[model samples]
Target: MKNIIENLKEYALETIEAEAEAVSQLPGIVDDGFGEAVALMARCKGRIVVSGVGKSAVIAQKMVATLNSTGTCALFMHSADAVHGDLGMIGPGDIVLFISKSGNTEEVKRLLPFVKKMGNPVVSIVSNRDSFLGTHSDRLIYVPMEREACPNNLAPTTSTTLHLVVCDAIAMALSRFKNFTAEDFGRFHPGGSLGKRLYMRVEDVFDKTNQPRVSEDETIKNVLITISSHRLGATVVLGPDGDLRGIITNGDVRRMVENGKDINTLQAKDIMSRSPKTVDKSALAVDALRMMEANNITSVVVLDGGKYAGLIHIHDIMREGIQ
Candidate 1:
């Protein structure tokens, strides 16, 4: 049993090391062909159509997904399905990427004529430049020669890893060529933790019940009540005309008491900070958090079109996993 466990550990490590070494040699193998392929896709007017068969097909699907999420429009057409009616998904001006490690996958090679007839550029990522798919392609990006982790060199181990790395590199290059920003990426995501971090607005964080607000003329005692009631650490002070006046926080209350001031005689305006930090409710919550960080504060007053909206606490951002 101990010998079996040791063999298992060594086997896994060997697989990882083999794949890593294959990936490391990719830069040396990259040449003008890869650059031309990226330039073709970057200049493509329509979506990129990625097609492959078997293990390479799975890599193609992942590549399509990454391309779409990173601002480059893309779709996956299974090589076998493309031979059916899936070829209709390809439109004029589209770029088709054919992924095949051996460059001779029958299903992938069958689409070469159809891709050419569509008048779209066909780029092949293959290990054998002399194979049918590579010879028929308009351009070829060669994958470095890889020996599979399979003892018999038959399983798609290192080859598939290299395919993933190559696809990701192309997607990132296209992303840089288009100058895609985090905000652009957020628009596509919009559901995961990444979307929440990038797209969450101050309005989403601060709402009516959590808005600790009090009139400027309200007594310090009333201000403290609002702050404590809402549990937002501070109260937004407003004027009689509903304009922002100042903010009174628990710290202000503590300082006033420490200074031996007549807490009973003070109004909300008396102990409040006139230049309290404020954020537009429409602003990104991440940006509001940056404001809080820069000002060394824990909360800020939220305004909607220059009017008081609510209060945003640092804890609110934290709850969204922004940090």
Candidate 2:
């Protein structure tokens, strides 16, 4: 079974090669029609109505999503739904982009009457530039590829990738035109993981119970108690005047063994990390995790407005997974 699996996995390499070739062919097809499509979308006052059926339907939905996130207003109207009176989604001065690999999908053709009646420019994405939808469109963008990534060469793998890549290109062009930012992307995807990653701040993922501290005059036993109570293997140490001095950790206590100092007699200031890695409480948790990994530290001391606030351990980072 293992041998058979290894042989079968070789097909994945073939699929990758095909996908790369498909993407490489995309640049040659971009020309005046591409510029016209961008210009139409940029100037249109109404929404961009994107319609497709079958596998093309999936690509159309993603394209519309990318468009909406990158400053172009777009609505995905399913072709089956369009024929069933969903054509009302399109308004005058709008632009329609219809997607079909063969340019003759039965459901896709059903949307033509509404497209014609809307009095908007029609743009078609198809393999055959002379097919029905292609001939009717004001402009046509041809994918021109003749193969698929599947072993049978029948699946929509390569063509769908091309569709999405072209969609992303158009969206990024609009993003440059409008200066779309990360905050802008957050507006359209407020309910998903990417949205949270974009907007959720460090304060949202910070540990609230930061009750672990040891004074500079605190005994070694008291420092141990602070470390155990915090469960972070460390604690912040403060000077007699109540200002931050350094940090005390288990490793710091262990070093006393070599110096012949008594654990219970020593003060926290005798052994502590003076220059601890500090992070702002307002930074993203994901970024904090990266900092911990880069510095090879298990925890970080968090500060609020330049004041000691809390400590975050590596476990807290994983359990929260970037709020």
Candidate 3:
């Protein structure tokens, strides 16, 4: 069958190289217009309305999503639908961003007149800076693509890649100009695990049932029961004033037994390691995991107001993908 798989792999590599070459030209073309486009979107009083046709439509939708997620309010409108009453979605101060490689796509050209009548500033991201949309737009950002990855030089391959990269760049620039933070990004992705990882505090992951505790005067027999019940591999030892004293792990019990001491007579003060690691309950869950790894331990004590709050185990961090 002419080794169809190998032939396909070769063609894929060639397409990637062509697209990469096209992208290599982007750096030189990024000039004052790029900054101006970002300023326009940043200064916009209303939503950013991104419109395009065909392949550009796909990029526009993705750009809209990126913009909205990173603190910029944006919406996607297909070029064909804009003239058919979707133009109602465009507000007085909204900025219309048009994405078209050719700058003369039929659907986009047809919508440009209505776009102009709406009196909003039109910014065009087009490969041909001299084309209709390019010259007519209030501001134009040029993306000069040499050719497509298509062997026939007709399909939208490298051209679409350029469109996506340009839009991503603009969206990122807007995000930076607005000083978007990770906490701000978390607000937009609260439904996903990533949001939890970024925003979930250490206290949010603490388990009440896993609070292994013992006082200094308590017996080893009492420590064993607490550690077993809590299943946290260790128990916290508190002083007479109920302050944090030390920690005794299952290994401490084993080592005490191995030392041939009278296991029944040991107290929490005798076996506990006085220097237990602790993390503030207000710390991020990810930061707690970092402390655990750095100390080569599996769990850490949680403190609130300088008092014992609870324990955060490595398992809690792993469940959140921080490991």
Q: Which parts of model 1 are misplaced by more than 4 Å?
A: 1-7, 208-210, 215-217, 239-245, 251-275, 293-297, 304-307, 318-321
Indicate whether candidate 1 or candidate 3 has the larger TM-score: 3
Q: lDDT by residue for model 2 over 1-323, one digit each (tens)? A: 99889887887888989899889989988899888877777787888888898889999999998888778889998988887888877888789989888898878777786688768888888888878888888878888887889878899999899988888888898788888888778777776667656775566766767647888888888888889987888899876665678887777777787778887767888888889888888887777878889988778888888878888777776664453
Ranking by lDDT: 3, 1, 2
Q: Rate the local accuracy (lDDT) of all candidates.
A: 0.89, 0.82, 0.89
Model 2 deviation from the true structure expressed as Cα RMSD, one decimal place: 2.9
Error of 1 at 51 (Å): 0.6
lDDT of 1 at 15: 92
- Clash pairs, candidate 2, are none
lDDT of 3 at 19: 93
For TM-score, the strongest prediction is 3
In candidate 1, position 104 carries an lDDT of 89
Q: How many angstroms is residue 81 displaced in model 1 relative to the true structure, after the best TM-score fit?
A: 1.5
Residues 1-323, model 3: lDDT tens digits: 57998899999999999899888888887888878877888899999999999988999999999999998999999999888899999998999999999999989889998889989999999989899998999989998887899999999999899989888888888889899999988778876777776888898888855677899989888889999988888989987787999998888899999999886787889998999999999898988988888988888999988998878889987887655
